[model samples]
Target: MKNNFSHFLASLIAVPVGLIFWVLSSNIFDIHLFLDVLVGIGGFGASYLPTQQIFHKKHLDKYKLTNSEYKYIKEQLNQADEQIKRLRSSYMNIRTIKDAKMIYEINRIIKTIISSVEEEPRKFYRGQQFFHSNLESAVNTIEKYLYLYKMPGKSKQERMQLHETRLSLLELKRTLQSNLSHMNASSYDDLDVERELIKRNADRSKKRQALLTNKLDKEKINLKKDQAKEYVYRGDKNGE
Candidate 1:
């Protein structure tokens, strides 16, 4: 919202700056009105485009997103936001605390996935199931469950359906968790690789240090032996 507002404010400033430029150019140079209008539009664009670029560049830098990635992620976010709203509506119809908590947990997981995807757009691809199908399915299932739950009287079959729906929701929650784990699997892999590298380097360093220590110890032993021989020779020569 703040970023959008900045663009809007920049546009407002640009309009006036453009008009001023147009007026100045026309009066000073006595240019044609068509040229003046063109200059005005150009001025507006020049002013607004830079501001937009600056804001967009900052946004891209913050998320490390390419323009295409940002646009795709934004589209996905919009769709997710609409689905989440529907999901929340189902929450309002929930009757039991247990069911409410379940819905809350699902919502929490979906939001966490969204937040992760927002920070790293590449995760959207990894979490396509949650972002694309599972989320919408969750909304539909919850709403259907709640609708059946609030019926005047549930038949044995309807109650059984409800039971299955509940189970399905639980399974869906687990699936969402799996999706999140999938999204972060690469990060975990990277961490594991780094840990292995560090361990190898540390072991190598320790070996090098140990070898150096052993060499120094051998040198010291040899030096001591040489010193003792020299002392014996000096004492024997002095006695002679």
Candidate 2:
């Protein structure tokens, strides 16, 4: 092979090059210098060969993922994308000051999740675990926000908005939990279930978004209808 030939050539050249340097130094100054040069060359060769072999092995191994593993990884990536989309949509719709703070915390959590999913496979499990921890923290923050918003004295509109936002937060919590479960269950050979889980989670998120959007639209329409009815009632009373 070309690689073997190159290694052979390198070894051949290294000995002669080392010897040439030794001779030149000896001729100019001292024999001890030549002996020290030879010792140095020996030490270099001893360290270099094993290091080169290890590096070569690692490099070759990096490209050898099983097809199923690759598919599973791709599925996880898709799940991450879906999560980001949902987070961005939810963040844009956030209205109240309390909800805005929750959005900020969710944004941080989503960023961590995205980073973990993008990390090299060699580092994935650890990175994903850290991401899951952040997600839990985000969930706790949302729970606290929901609790604070549930107190007395809120306008009807505020209460409705809080209820919808709380629903979104619960959906997010479910998605995170599903993702963490998949990450924990994943392995080299049996990733089929993990892939399915991710796909299912993404599907659930899409459904949740659709439901939230529809509900928000309905609420807006109902509010307009109620205002129109109130105006009509007042006009009829005045005419009477």
Candidate 3:
């Protein structure tokens, strides 16, 4: 964010600097109008290029991913995005709420899978079934199923084909669910470990707190006893 702000600031500064250059060239140096404009552009470029390069370098390095890996992941994500669009488009062909609910569930799974892969690019490897096959298959199956279901006066054979395609869509949904589970299994394991550690730390903290409270109570009792002894001695001296 800071880098982006700096880039914006640089751009804002460049525009004015460019104008200044143009004004100085035309008025003070008596340069030609075209040359003045060129000088202004050169000034803008000079002011903008350094910050632009710096911002890009920092932004790219922030991910700690190599350029090639980043590029490949970006390309794959773009393809996944297109597949998702096709899937959503297929949803419009759904006439029944029952099948619509299935598509919705499948959509949720696909989004979660993509989001997980996006957050941890390495998980993209785990979702090869989704990005490479299952998602595309689902889209194709949904389209084919709807196309058949919409046919006029479908004969028995056509109805059976529609039924089979519906089955294929259900199977695709299950496969997508499996793909999502596979992709997130490692993350779930990590979460389990983290939760265990947090629980252990919390238990230790509770024990320490209990011990400290006990110590404080003991000190309070001891202080009360000492005060009683002092009062008794003073009373005995006064009596003497």
Candidate 4:
């Protein structure tokens, strides 16, 4: 209510103040040309735009998420930011180009998602589950890879374990990449709320699939029996 009143009051005063300035400036400069009169009017109108929006925060209106949704997303973004910082601090100690490159790409994706969420929080909120799960997994896998690589390995088993971990981390990175399509912006903002409904539907679908599979298996068995009888009939005819 206060904000609305402030905006209304600003609008009411802006034009009059502009007109006063125009009139005073025009007469003092003895401006009489048509273009000059129009320019004076526009100048005053443009000057008040800043004051008109002074009460609002810039770029906040760009996001369409509800306040609660925004709060949740912002919390996740802060966690991703801290993970990125940790990766950066470990950069100098990264043993391989593969690790360094993967870490860099992880940083890039985190920043990109953060910016997208800030700009259009509602659009990306549908993928909140996908985003949070995959992003945290990626960060943890990377951190584990770094730790294992930095540890000194004297035994053959330790070396083998390090190799296996690297391979697993690579697979984790690929899995994260594959899930990126789901992390993209979507129109639905209530996806987090609808997760339970989605799970129920998925369960029903699996049950239906299982029922279909059983029906098909019975048909296959019956068809095989009929084929066997036909083969016996054909052999009897040949004997005749």
Candidate 5:
């Protein structure tokens, strides 16, 4: 309301100043000579009110979009949840000690994903970084567990289960690696979007600051003009 009132006052003030210029120019020279200039000044002052209001509204909307990054993050979280379910089911069905160890190793990897998702991304450079770090640790642990449980001679069923577990671990590792790569690429894109938004906001602030500075300069010029007119009037009275 205060802003609207100020805009109204500016327009009220500009219209008469424009009319005074029109009158002065008409008296000294031709009425049409300064008519366009007077119209332009008055029109600009009137239009500025709506323009400034629109700009302020836009800035407010931009600041409200901080959660836009959550869309991509949520998809990654869902994938992690699915992986956890698969690992948990596999762990429950293990009969042999070797099979149990293999399932335990897989569970460790899934747990890493869960922990990564639970941690705040704002605390890290990117969400992928946390996942990747934990993934390396999980893989190392899995390799160590496999080496400890190696049997030189094994029965057919045990050998088959070992092969299946190895295959599953390899597949899981591939999936984790692919997901991490894609996530890193997407993080770069996200950073670009954020950077562009910051640049736009900075540009807007600069423009608003410039407009305010120009308005202050104009007021100062008007004050000097009024002082000059007073001095001229006083000198004329003394001469008379």
Candidate 6:
């Protein structure tokens, strides 16, 4: 919508272009109506968003996706982002510690998927697929359960249903967690490698510093030994 010169140009040209084609065909053949319609469609197609969507959009480059994949994945990512936003709205209304923790984990997973795609799209795409599969159902299930829990005056059956729903949501959360566990494990391995690198550098630095200190101490001791011999020789000469 922002820089839609094509649409504006189409709006300006379509009528004149259609009319010109109509007049030319009217003189040239009896198929003026068909020509007019064809030109009109061509103008509209040029101005359509789908045409623009397939073009090499620079912003989508960050995700490292092809034009088609960019469109598809961007749509899915937007849906998940919206769901995460809605879930955040319920933070203050959360009742139990367990529910809060569940929400935190879900947000963590969603945010990680979003970040990982920008940095490492290939590695994070599996997480993206998992998100697409679960996001809508998980949102509905959690929100519906929370809504029911908040509403007053539940019958015995409704109470029973609430408990069942809670169990189901718990199971769903656990399922999502299980799928994300492998991703978390890979991250932990990366952290371990980084930790070892830092430790090795620190060890090297300490050893270098200790070696310099030892060398300086030996030089000082040798200087003192040489000075003592000179003093004894000068004292014997004075006695003579």
Best by TM-score: 3
Give lDDT tens digits, candidate 2, residues 2-116.
1244355556556665565666666765669658687557755765576555544553356354545545655665655655565555454445786676567556656645554
Q: What is the lDDT of residue 87 in candidate 6?
A: 79
Return the top candidate by lDDT.
1
**Whole-model Cα lDDT of every candidate shown, in order:** 0.86, 0.60, 0.82, 0.66, 0.58, 0.68
- For candidate 6, give the lDDT: 0.68
Model 5 ranges with Cα > 4 A deviation:
1-112, 115-141, 145-178
lDDT of 2: 0.60
**Which candidate order results from sorting by lDDT in descending order?**
1, 3, 6, 4, 2, 5
Per-residue accuracy of model 1 over 1-240 as CA lDDT, tens digit each: 124755876787789989988998799978999999999899998898888787777867776678887787788889999998888777667788899889899899999998888667777888887877898898898898988898877799989989999999999999999999999999899999999999999999999999999999999999999999999999999999
Better of 4 and 6 by TM-score: 6
- For 46-77, candidate 3 gives per-residue lDDT tens digits of 98888677766666577566667767877888
Q: How far out, in Å, is residue 14 in model 4?
A: 16
Q: For candidate 2, what is the total of clashing residue pairs? A: 0
Better of 3 and 5 by lDDT: 3
The TM-score between candidate 4 and the true structure equals 0.48
What is the TM-score of each predicted model, taking all chains together?
0.72, 0.31, 0.79, 0.48, 0.33, 0.59
lDDT of 4 by residue, 64-170 (tens): 44446556776776776786777677677788887778777767766666666555666355556546686777667667767767877448887887788777766
Clashing pairs counted in every model: 0, 0, 0, 0, 0, 0
Evaluated at residue 10, the lDDT of candidate 4 is 58
Candidate 1, residue 59: CA error in Å? 5.8
**Candidate 5 positional error at 184, Å:** 4.8
In model 5, what are the clashing residue pairs, if there are any? none
